[model samples]
Target: MTLDARSLIKAYFAEGTLPGLPDGHFIGGRIVANSDGDRLESYDPGNGQAFARFGAGKGEDVSRAVEAAQQGLAAWRDTPPATRCQVLNRAAALIRERSDYFAVVEAVDSGKTLAEARGDARSCIRLFEYYAGIADKLEGRSIPLGSGLTSWTEREPVGITAQIIPWNYPSSTFVRGVAPALAAGCAVVAKPAETTPFTALLLAQWLHEAGVPAGAVNVVTGLGSDAGAPLVRHPSIAHVTFTGSVATGVGVMQAVAPNVTQLTLELGGKSPLVALADCDVDKAVEGALWAIFSNAGQICSAGSRLVVERSIHAEMMEKLVARTRTLKLGHGLKDPDVGAINSRQHLDRIARHVEAARGRGCSILTGGSATHDPASNSGWFFEPTIIDNLAPSDPAIQQEIFGPVLSVQVVDGEEEALAMANATEFALVAGIYTGDIGKALRLARSIDAGQVTINDYWAGGIEVPFGGNRKSGFGREKGIEGIDAYVRTKAITIRH
Candidate 1:
């Protein structure tokens, strides 16, 4: 709660409710705003007001960014691996220096609470640090093919990479993709989600100050059709890492198809949190609350589905509801327990999902409607909701709601719980809260998610590899495997 709040907030609101906003695409280290007259206005969801005007990029802007990255590729890739890592270490230090300001901007643009945004800023710093530490450790292996010939593999940079960041996690996603790509010595052309574009551009500028060449990192902000699509399709972009909806991810897949660009997509999730009868009920309730309520449940891996054992069903609901009802709501600047929804359209989407579930005879446990922040009374604020009495066939249980909604499904035992959990189309992350480690391991093996957590909702930090299966999209990000998308292995043999 003790951030540099007063002065930062005062400075942010100086330009008529807008912060020191960056208003143009950052290409070759320069801010280009006047090249295209089309502009996009960014609104602060906390106040439901337009506070920024930036460029609305077209295919042409994406082309310029691609050219800049191509020019920056050789110098970056040829630099000693250790030197490349030192730049990220410097960037991490810069992030720590600017953490307070970055957190404030992130909270404003993404509609997450200031506390949550601060956590994200810390996560960003750790992401860069983690990748930087491992840059030199990314080694190629030698294969023995008899004594006469020496054979070894070289891990080389995958040239220019295209990153399409999402609105939910603006800053962290930008760092998450860019950090690893740069560590792999690949120049990057990134397009931040139009809704939350400012922080990424600012981060790009900071990277230059941290010694990354200006052309080595470019941020183009615009609509997905206008800028994102073009960046994905550019032939020079050797790898593309995107995080967003399944529908949009599918489009990215197709766009990269003609060029056959290598892709890494971290998409949607209807992730489950399974609470078995033998689990510690108190811990299960705590995990359920954090999983569905954190960041207003906007994360790709948010445990939105609660699969509870039949014996503990009533007790679990009682505790979950009591804790959920106590959650506070206010503007993100105020750092309440729950903050504003990202946009009116997303708010409407959340409302429609709840209405559809209620219509299908699902029982509402506590909250099932939208409520405004009592303080500001302007932005869209949905009460943290918990829906119960879900039928197995309920769309509410199957689809990714991507909001502050947790739907509960009661199961007789572990067998039924596993079956019900895997019933969804997504396989992102799963949490199993049980005292029995052997039982948890057995259940984990059976779950289809990319990552599984035992006892906690968000169990790992930046070091864990994360992604999803089935409709959640493919390829991995974070940890050692994260750099895989930005690098390719070349096998070389020497004959004596």
Candidate 2:
């Protein structure tokens, strides 16, 4: 019999006595049920079906996980760097071995295409492997002091770290934060987004199989207000790393303030993609499509604002609208070009933005509504939308829509394009596409984003640093800088 998404899902679940759902938080070493015995159902964004349930982590659960992390920190901190590298490498291997299963779970949980979910799994593996290679290389420096005195600095783990992951890219986001913390010899209390916690639970099992010490990495699943708030406020948590909206990130920062907890925030962005008249129009169009429509445009650094030179603005708009119309929309399991939005609430949010843009007299060039497939009628799907004739100050142009929506703005020249790109408060990412290498490089420099792509979007691999500037929040992830976020420096002095 031929295999479809439903068949594949059923077969995967039927193959073994895998980790059961309605899981409690992964504390100390094993799955521990919530003390209050509360449960939260996880829905499939592809069909709006509740496929699994998990114990809703609460303040009590956060406390228990924190206690476990606090108790386990010493052993993890004392573990040799070589051994830590070995463990992280093993975890990477395990993730690769179960890549198919993890990919399916991520697709079913997050509504991203199976291919995208597989990419997420691969990214998770690469993150661990990258951190493993660098685990032993986190060296300190020798400082020059008086002639008779010798001084040196050493990097050490910052104790228990609390990571609050978002649902957009659950598996990769979870590992991206946890791997570096573990590599840096810090215990982690990870809280995956409640909407997509299953893969995180499965990842916890893989970590255990990879010989991670119990309590060294824990998974807590619950609402942000309930479990996340308490974890951020918990005095025992040494550091906090959060990825979400600006409002919630602010709440996290505020909660951690009483204790002055060290923190890293990767908030939202209204990234810009500029297409110059000198660029290959086809290549620019492709880059713009991938930049905005990948993962249904839910990425934090998605190039949602399209700025094209006035000379080629009309041609570029026609090309973008035509290409967007050809994109297939369906459930993620089917590997459609555009998959369902992450959830009902998110779909509603996107709808509100589109409606507001229309109300403001912004022209909807094409696709300003939702579409549904008969096979997955319950899915929360939004059409790929292109809006034009909006001022730079328009809310739809300035705010983070976090959906498959692209706002096009015409500019007279490169200088004006750069000005419009940086006009927003967000400075997470920006992209420039031009055949003139010198002009591309110059435009890249002029853009005020933490990460800039020239002639392409998302140009770098996992080895490069990624974060944001201005309102996009601080602290870097995904490079040597990622590791530094989990560590602190101490100076040692010796007198002869």
Give Cα-based local distance difference scores for all models: 0.89, 0.88
Candidate 1 residue pairs in clash (backbone atoms < 3 Å): none
Error of 2 at 490 (Å): 0.6
Q: Which 10-residue window in model 1 sums to the lowest lDDT?
A: 11-20
Model 1 TM-score is 0.97
lDDT of 1 by residue, 1-496 (tens): 2347667777665653545668899999778873578898888887788877888999999988888998888778887889988999999998888888788888888889999999988988999999998778778899989979999999999999999999999999999999999998999999998889988988898898898886999999999988888889898999999999999899989989999989998999999899999999999999999899998888899999999998999999999999999999887888699888898899889999999988877899888888788876788788899999687888889888889999999999889999998998899999999989988999999999999999988889899999999999898888888888888899999998
List where candidate 1 sits over 4 angstroms from the true fold: 1-3, 11-18
Identify the leading candidate in terms of lDDT.
1
Model 2, residue 50: C-alpha shift (Å): 0.7
- Across 130-216, the per-residue lDDT of candidate 2 in tens digits comes to 999888988999999879999999999999999999999898988888999999999999999989998888888788779888888
The CA-based lDDT of model 1 is what? Answer: 0.89
TM-score of 2: 0.96
- Candidate 2: lDDT of 119? 92
- Winner by TM-score: 1
TM-score of each: 0.97, 0.96
Listed per candidate, the RMSD to the true structure in angstroms reads 1.7, 2.4
